[model samples]
Target: MEVIQVKNLSKNYGALQAVDRVSFAVPEGSVFGMLGPNGAGKTTTIECIIGLQKRSGGEVTVLGLDPAISRKELYGSIGVQLQETVYQDKAKVFELCQLFSSMYPDPLDYKLLLERFGLEAKTRTYLRNLSGGERQKVAIVLALIANPRLVVLDELTTGLDPQSRREMWAYIKELQAEGRTIFMTTHYMEEAAHLCDQVCIIDEGRIVALDTVDGVIENAGMDTMISFETQDEIGMVLEKLPGVNRVEQEHEQVRLYSQKEDVLTDLILLLREHAVEYRKINISRPGLEDAFLQLTGKEWKEKVS
Candidate 1:
């Protein structure tokens, strides 16, 4: 069942086009990822859905109800976590959860939510004194305490360390099992790849790619990077070999790229012929990070550089 459907969604600010005719449907009880770079208009598209921002054109429906026309009804069924959260630092963690829960007609148990989120220990901690990760957990707890039928999370794990982030992902999986539909946005490709059942890749307010994580990889068909130890100046040898598109001698490692899995097979045979003593071989497939670059025409490496 489709819980959310957007068509020809367009949003603009003065002369700048924020979202341009983007269309996609999110099925019920699925983890949907809205992915893009910082200026990719993801937030604008999401805001349009939640009726936080009015669109210049297009239509948005959540649970078959139009956002603009049914704003109040929609809020009762949807939970939202914004990219940045503002709260009184003096408010105790448990107190905040109770306050948010009271606002909803049917809310989850505050105590259970706190324990599940590993926040019971900090129940008395003031919001202002919490670490970035801890404060994020508090925000998540308030969002979910509503027990909303649909949850909209933006950069859910932005400030979290790897361990806490993983724990939170696990919680989301649990929520899915309870049949809640989720629509979230994040720049963390790996997190989206692992958690999202379907992904909408947007850029400059337009939809670029929309599909399952595996489907996107299959579409790109980029070869993975494989590294191996080889002697015999494998540089020139592997360069002329089939299935090995590029070869370089970096210290003592030979790097290879191939869309075909047999690239390593041919490399091994050549190594045997040269009687080279190999240490180890490593192979990795192209991930969501690679797909993002290919679709956006942006070098992801440069971003980190």
Candidate 2:
């Protein structure tokens, strides 16, 4: 079943179009990733779908109801955690949890939530005294307390440590197991690749690519990367080589980008014929970041940084 659907969704700020004719569908009980660099219209599209921001054009439906018209009914079935969340600085950890729980029809157990989030020791700690990561944890706990059927998590693991991030990912997987659908926006390509059943790659408010993890890789024409150590700077005209698109130099290492699997083999044969001395030769398939860069023509560094 389709839990969320957006058709020709567009948002404009005067002359600048933030999201232009964006369209996608998120299935029920699946993790749908909305991925892009900074100013990609990802957040704008999300706001439109969630009915937090009015859409200038197009259609949006969440759980078979128009978000703009049926927002009140939809709120009960959806949990939302924005990128930036703040609470009363003087409130204690337990107090904040209890406060948010009261807003829900039947929230998760307060003690269980505290234990699940490793905040038991900090139960008495004031919100202002908590670290950035801990604050994020509290925010997430509040968002999920309702056990809503759908969850929209923007930058879900932004301030988490590696261990905490992994744990949160596990928790999200468990939520899906219990038949909850997740719509998430993230700058981390690896996170999307690992957790999302489908992803939509947005750039400048438009979907440049949308598909499964493997499908995006294939569609972006990112197949192989060849690397090896060389003694002399072998000025091989790699740009003219078949299936090779670009060549880059890092220190004394050469990395070649190509969609052809045979490019590495061909390079080895060429090196052997030319007596090019080298060591530590290797070939690797492209990762999610590689595919993302190829498709959107935007650097991940530009987003996360």
Compare the candidates by TM-score and give the number of the best one: 1
Candidate models: Cα lDDT each:
0.85, 0.84
Q: Write down the TM-score for model 2.
A: 0.83
**Model 1 lDDT per residue over 1-305, tens place:** 89999999999899999999999999999999998878789889888999988889988889989998898888888988888765888899988888888888889999998898888999998888888778887887888887898999988887678888887788889888999999999878888987999998888888888999988876876877888775546678777778666766787887887777687788788788888877778898998888888888875531210
The alpha-carbon lDDT assigned to residue 99 of candidate 2 equals 82
**lDDT, candidate 2, 138-160, per-residue tens:** 87678778878899998877766
TM-score of each: 0.88, 0.83
User: Candidate 2: worst 10 consecutive residues by lDDT?
Assistant: 296-305
By summed lDDT, the worst window of 10 consecutive residues in model 1 runs over: 296-305
* Best-fitting candidate, scored by lDDT: 1
Instruction: Please list the residue runs of candidate 1 whose C-alpha ends up more than 4 Å from where it truly belongs after superposition.
Output: 233-253, 269-277, 301-305
